[model samples]
Target chain A: MEKTNIRTNKNFNKVSDIIESLTINTNPDSVAVLEEIGTNSSIDEVRELTSRALVKRNEHDSLQVVISNRGKGINDMSTIVAMSTINELLSLENKEEAMRVLENTISSEGFDEEVKENARSVKALMALS
Target chain B: MSAIEKVNQLSHRIFNTSKNEQSTSRTSNPFAASNFQKNILTEDVFESSKSKEANKVNFTGNLSASSKRIYSVFVGSINDIGSRISSGIESIKAFGSRMKEGIVNTCVNTWNKIHEIGNKEESLNGTKELLGRDITTFFVNKREREISKMANMNPHMEVKSIFKDALQALEADMVQVA
Candidate 1:
């Protein structure tokens, strides 16, 4: 494993920047950046930034945008990010709607079978909830 | 006998007798040419009977009931086997593709998680001094809304316990950092 150093102030500034961007305007690029930091950075603050951004995004964007972004296929990082964000938010509540999205993912011809199976697992998890 | 009446009787006998003679003998017309009568008979049997025999063979009504049933079952089984083989191959292909996808995603997720943790561990190295109050402030602010939502909106005990565990981890982090 390759270890990389990120200064504490730099991490704080990046998190602040992400929070600022998420609060002010959430374009695809901003969403992309937050997701990158969340998945790549070792800092919990950065992941929290991503979590917060997703919450903000869920509030600002339409469900169609979330679903469309998710259905763009799983090969892209953005799609994974969108999926994780949607999954997190939908898991909080909205069981029926989440199940609907999971079903669409499972049944749609475009998604990878593994991704569909992952969605199935998520659906099963939701059922427990 | 009158001359015209005898000629007419001779003409009827020759024409009628010639057709019957053509069936019985190869040389039916002794003087009028045997090949012409043979040609006519060949055409009548070959062209007419050929079509009649073909028609009879084509109609299933000519076949026995048991033979017809056997033929029907044979054709039906061939169709059934063809469809079953095709569907079986399709499902196998689908299963193979799914296995490939699962392996790929598993590798990808593992790689991402490992890299992220490695990077975090690297950053945290020698940072035991800077973490206390700063980390406390971060988790406290970040989790407040989430914890409140889980406590209020959702009534499930499992969900509450999960949130409580997460909150406990944050508090543990806060204690370590502070």
Candidate 2:
């Protein structure tokens, strides 16, 4: 598990570098360039870049979808990520469904013990309602 | 009872008895040996050099007190803006209703005045007095239409100003955060 974490970290760092390079080289203001990059890049590369950038932006965002997904040192990083996730979820009309997704994500075994415990407390409080 | 259940009950009773004794002891002499040990362990741990170093490291991380203050400020400002915008909308709605009522009242008063004048005198010197009433009514209608149009556009203008202010506030906040 530790080895896999190190590997993921390295991969994320590499992808981050690639994204920074892309951002520097490409015109961010131009939707055409973004669309072109999306179309031209290999499916795996695009997915990896998008996923890693999102993770870099907020690790808990990816975790909210899959409960058991573990990243050791990402708890502090989760707040901004969680806020962004909540913001996105709020944008959708089906807010209750979005909240359910958030709940399920946090409940998953992939989350750290503290996060899981917090989620459990929240669930308990919600159940009281 | 089963052996384990009997043992559990006995242990629980013993624990409860000891806890009661400890509480009684605390009231008499709070700085007793057990209390001293508990205080030393909890308090001294926080005051220790190792704990201080750990805290220093934690403080440098994203969830530091300063970062938390910034996040709190952000959330607070957003909430304030949301509230102000909503209240502004409500105020505009209230203004619209009041304006509508005012226009209706004016129209009703003008009609009453015209009816009273027409009843009082059947004819004027040369031209019909109803023509003057019609011209006044036309001007009132035009003015009401203009007021309605302005009222309809006012919300959009206010919305634009609110958005502009919000963007400015956000930019200033970002600069502060940076």
Candidate 3:
């Protein structure tokens, strides 16, 4: 029975390793593993861990910008990049620079009233600093 | 009927039967429904307590009324400081560049004067020293304070309490789940 338990544990470890590798290489497989793990683990635990991971990733990106831009003697360039990157991260609803880019794209063409109203709402929902 | 629709109908009947059985069991045991209701009430109480705690920390009412006012003033102040610092740096650079030009001009004038006196080498050395000092001063003080202030403002701790409270709430949620 102990040997059987050992075997089962090894199988579980193998599955977990496969899942981890899949998370980097295959989007659908990663989602499947995430779902499986989410069902097996506590749902809130998964969400909290994911949230922390996202925050850490954002911090890492910000730090990378600072480190790379240091000693360049170009303050304005560094300041603008840092501010824009932070604003992008802190802007919750827009997800990416999509809303800003979309607004610019739409406005370059003459504004239709309907499109303008939609853009306005989107901007409000996804306001950046 | 489609296969999916037929399967759904069958599932619905099964669900109804299970629900009926549950209701019959509840009717038979008076304590069961009361216990279930008690659990529901407890859950609602917990949720309300959590919400109240969140609201207290958030300063929700004060925030709604005065946040915009405070932020606009804060931003305006920062902008004013920033512009002043930028202008000051620019002015300093201009002044330094001008001073360097002035020194060179003065050297040229002195060189002409000393050449008349047959002392050209002495005047040339003096001009070099003057230009070097001016350039050093120019580069040394370029927006130093402004850059320091900007760096200080990064990773602001103003909303740290809110983040702490959020983390605390998450921990509490994890504990409850466990």
Pairs clashing within candidate 3: none
Q: Per-residue lDDT for B17-111 in model 3, tens only?
A: 65334654534334433456435222222235556787878643656557868887898999999999999999999999899999999999998
Give the candidate number with the greatest TM-score.
Answer: 1
C-alpha TM-score for every candidate: 0.27, 0.18, 0.17
Off by over 4 Å in 1: A1-9, A16-52, A55-91, B1-178
**Per-residue accuracy of model 1 over B1-178 as CA lDDT, tens digit each:** 9999999999988776765465545433343334564464332333356567877778676777799899889889989998899999989989988998899889989998999999888778647536866798787676554444433432233332342343345435445555
Evaluate residue B16 in candidate 3 and report its C-alpha lDDT on the 0 to 100 scale. 66
Q: Rank by TM-score, highest first.
A: 1, 2, 3
Model 3, TM vs. native:
0.17
List DockQ for all candidates: 0.01, 0.00, 0.00
Q: Output the lDDT of residue B163, model 2.
A: 27
Q: Which ten residues in a row have the lowest lDDT in candidate 3 chain A?
A: A67-76
**For model 3, how big is the iRMS in angstroms?**
18.8
Residue B37 of model 1, lDDT score = 46
Per-residue accuracy of model 2 over B1-178 as CA lDDT, tens digit each: 8999999999998776665355545343333325553552222222456666877876446587888899889989999999999999999999998999899899989999998788656656224657887889997676556434433332223322432343344334434544
- Backbone clash total, candidate 3: 0
- Our model 3 lands, by Cα RMSD against the true structure, at 57.6
